[model samples]
Target chain A: MAHLTYFNGRGRGEVIRMMLAAAKIPFTETFLTERQPFEKLIQDGLLPFKQVPLLKIDDMELVQTGAIVRYVAKKGGMYGADDKEATMIDMYYEASRDFYSKFLPVLFMKTEEQAVKDAKAAGEDKYFPALEKRLKETGSGYLLGTSLTMADVGFLEVLLLCVEFGGDDFLDDHSDVKQYYQRLVATPLMAEFLKSPFRKRKNDEQYIKEVKRVLNRE
Target chain B: MAHLTYFNGRGRGEVIRMMLAAAKIPFTETFLTERQPFEKLIQDGLLPFKQVPLLKIDDMELVQTGAIVRYVAKKGGMYGADDKEATMIDMYYEASRDFYSKFLPVLFMKTEEQAVKDAKAAGEDKYFPALEKRLKETGSGYLLGTSLTMADVGFLEVLLLCVEFGGDDFLDDHSDVKQYYQRLVATPLMAEFLKSPFRKRKNDEQYIKEVKRVLNRE
Candidate 1:
């Protein structure tokens, strides 16, 4: 059995959960919602880099969310269609990862509020459109190819986060992305996950407040 | 033929170059030493993310350094010994990539100098020790397994950069990492590359000065 350890929130662990679900793999989860428990886990040497979304399968342990996602994807047969497809998927994944990094400061902002917001706005203008372009270029109803790969799962998470922080119209300028977003959420397991009450429970008040404040430029 | 394009310096492209050399794969390179030429390539739609370290293999063009590194690692048979090994290699690669992300602001620091430098110092203190522990535990003379994989290649790059900025004594507290570093460089093609004058030219004057100043804590 695979065991995933992360915070209660869906911050970085959601993609892993979604991947496992898609593959029909059952796993246990241990959420670290407080500082003390998480610190204890770190002290216990459970985390490699002292970060969460750590996955343990039997005796094998792995860190890094991206790495874990790919590992699970490969195990579940959701990695990509082929080597070229895998490379393309990874390219978009890294690009989305870059977008996530920029979104983080604003999401957790305490200072230079306006500057950070403006930079995020500029980033959205750049990256989101590039993604939209790729969607059109591929025209495979997904990021890389026909089937839903790990890239789309990660990409959907990023898009949802962007919408949370950038407003509903975040991808309105790019019709393809908007449509792609709908198509992604409609994936069988993901769609079920979305409409489930568990989705609502996944929401953290503080997180919502931070995202709203950043979006509203408050 | 594989055509790799980036600036003349190492920045994100060196890892790709190292992987190619280690695999003994011959490829052509196009270096954009100036802003104008690089921008022209971006405008020409050569770069997907408008970023450097773009790899063009045949008709397929891929971006993102991490993705490119993995792609080359796969093609060169340096991906891993197997699926589990690949995941393990990726785990370490992502850890090293995270370390690289923290080291970046300090590398390109122009303001908030002391605060950034101090954070970088704290980061080094935390991550390097963890890496040292891994090296000791694995005891395989390499990061993941007995053979040299992409993880070692990427890890070596990060260590070299850390040493460049934090001085050679950066890894003094971590003898295992120190020994591992020597083992990496002593690889035939890598050693040859290091000895070649081309390595010296790969060093950008601005990069060295910036790194030196940060290490001096000025």
Candidate 2:
């Protein structure tokens, strides 16, 4: 048992959760709503940096989403067994993080136009090309090697987020990324997860719609 | 030979450079001095995400500071050999990244008052305690296992940035973090790194003074 503490939305927490699910790891998720508990957690110093997506493994806790994802990936055997492959997996994961750092801010915007403009300028112009090039270079289809690594899991979520929130057509201009996105969606576990109750929520639809809109615009 | 491409600063590029020095790996440091070249590289689609601190291995390019650090650490044998130990090493490196993310904005600020307020309210109040607790929990003195890992190297740079810019008294309240800083400074390689001509640049001191003045008010 692993426990993840975060808000209800996917955001940073989704990648680790999805990785765990794909790997068949059992974990409990504790979602905090409202400012009171968040403030209380801060005052009590329960959170390392007063941030969420903290992973609790038994008595020890790990903060930082990247670290948490890596920890979980290690447990799930998603990180390569060998050092060289592991390094490549780590590289891809970091690239995904860099991509998220740019696109995440745009998702929080209240209006669709602002999100589109930001995504087009940053997401389409910068992020997609880089990811497309990386995918093409790998030639293995997966972001890391033949099998899906945590990097693929992480990148898939971001691609989903872009289509789910930024708009579906966001990656239309970049064929490799689009193809990669389609391949990721075609995964049995991921496809099943998408069809679950988790994907039917209003917020989820809104995010997906926004992502679709962004894709269409492009 | 490894090649590092970044702006002429210690910023994100320092840890990689330091790791190479510690391991005695000979690598070319390609500093981009002008915006024109930086822009040109991005326009040519050379950069992954159009950012600096990219590591070139043979003909392949890698991005993300965290990913690059781990890759170099593995290559340099700075990361642990065992699975569990490597995970632990990664844990601390991730924590160091968390600390930097919290306090970096303060260092980048133009005014002294804002810098101090940001540090005290954000850095000291939030970041320091978290690091202090981790230091206390480690019990082995070093962040991970008995020997040094890239986590320590990365944290050393971050601590140096905080103290060199904010002042020794900046971490005065957090005894564990303070002791850790002292321990880092005691290392011969680190000490020599500190005294290098790179540390004496006028811009470095100016940035420190500016941030310190802001911290002083708080």
Candidate 3:
């Protein structure tokens, strides 16, 4: 049995959870709150990188989120079978990484104003347009060749974060990106997941709220 | 025949070049100076991401340095064939990415003091230890299990970058990482490649020199 160790809500662990749910894979969701098992795991070999979202597959433990997601995606048949589609899937996955790399550091900042400013300049100005263009180029609506791969799931998670942290109007300026976000949210599995009780802004809500307040003040 | 497009130096393109040279794969190295064909390519496709180090197979273009490296690694048989080895390879590759994510941004900073401070805090403090731990855990001396894989090559590239940008004394603080770098550099194929005229940091000399200057500044 595969065991996933993460915090209460979906953050780095969301894509893996969603993939498992969609594939009907039975696994233990070990939420590491500030409590018993969490504290124990932190002290033990579980927290190898001293980070959460670690996947325990039987005996082997995997740490990197990308590796874990790809492992799960491969098991779920969400990673494309053909080489071309797989390459395309990889392209989208890396592109999402590129997008996140631009804005992720901002979230670590103490000031909400600085975070919003950085997001606007980097996320809105640079990443969104590039993503929009790539989406259009794909021509199949999906980020990759045709089917919903892990790339789609990864992008959906990022888009969810954008709405939750960057606000409802996060996609207001980029129509294509906004449309893509809407399409993603409307997907049946995604919609259900979004409505599920498990869907909350894990450890990030305070930062999101603070950023929103700063934007209002500005 | 595969075609690699990048500037004259071994910036992101070096590993692919080395892999091809080791495999004796016939590929055209299209150096993009302020030249004609490069200008035509710029006007034609614009590199999808507007980045160098793109690989073109027949008509299709593949972007992203990691993606390109993986694709080439597969072609060169540097990535493992079996599932378990592949997973190990994936782990090392992911670790290399994690290491770079911490240090690459610091290299791009304008101020020398700020760059060194950030590198010390993030690069030396956070990344090096993580890499060292992984190297020790592998127990194979090479990054992955038993045999040398693309992960080792990828990591060697990162370590080489540290030495190039941070100077020879860069990895002096971490004995294991230093040993791993030396071991990688001693590989006959890698050693031969290093002796090649193409291995000189001529094209990227200015960037490296600036980085070294910043790193060495008290």
Query: Which candidate's lDDT is highest?
Result: 1
TM-score of chain B of each: 0.80, 0.77, 0.75
Q: What ranges in model 2 sit over 4 Å off?
A: A34-46, A57-60, A110-112, A197-218, B35-46, B57-60, B107-109, B197-218
DockQ of every candidate: 0.60, 0.42, 0.36
TM-scores, in order shown?
A: 0.85, 0.82, 0.78
- Candidate achieving the largest DockQ: 1
lDDT digits (tens) for residues B69-137 of candidate 1: 888888878878777889888988888777776666655543435645654575465566677777888
DockQ-derived CAPRI band for the predicted complex in model 2:
acceptable
| Higher-scoring candidate on DockQ, 1 or 2 | 1
Candidates 2 and 3: which is better by lDDT?
2
Judge candidate 3 at residue B117 and give its lDDT: 54
Residues A155-205, candidate 3: write the lDDT tens digits.
777777677677899889888988888987887877877777546554566
Ten residues in sequence with the least summed lDDT for candidate 3 chain A: A209-218
lDDT scores for all predictions?
Answer: 0.73, 0.70, 0.68
Per-residue lDDT tens digits for candidate 2, residues B49-144, read 667777787466776677778777887777887756676677667767766665566545557566655655666656677667767787866777
Alpha carbon lDDT at B144, candidate 2 = 71
**iRMS for all predictions?**
1.6, 2.5, 2.9
Candidate 1 residue pairs in clash (backbone atoms < 3 Å)? none
Off by over 4 Å in 3: A8-11, A22-26, A31-43, A109-139, A165-176, A202-218, B8-11, B15-26, B31-43, B109-140, B164-177, B200-218
Error of 3 at B104 (Å): 2.5
Who is ahead in TM-score, 1 or 3? 1
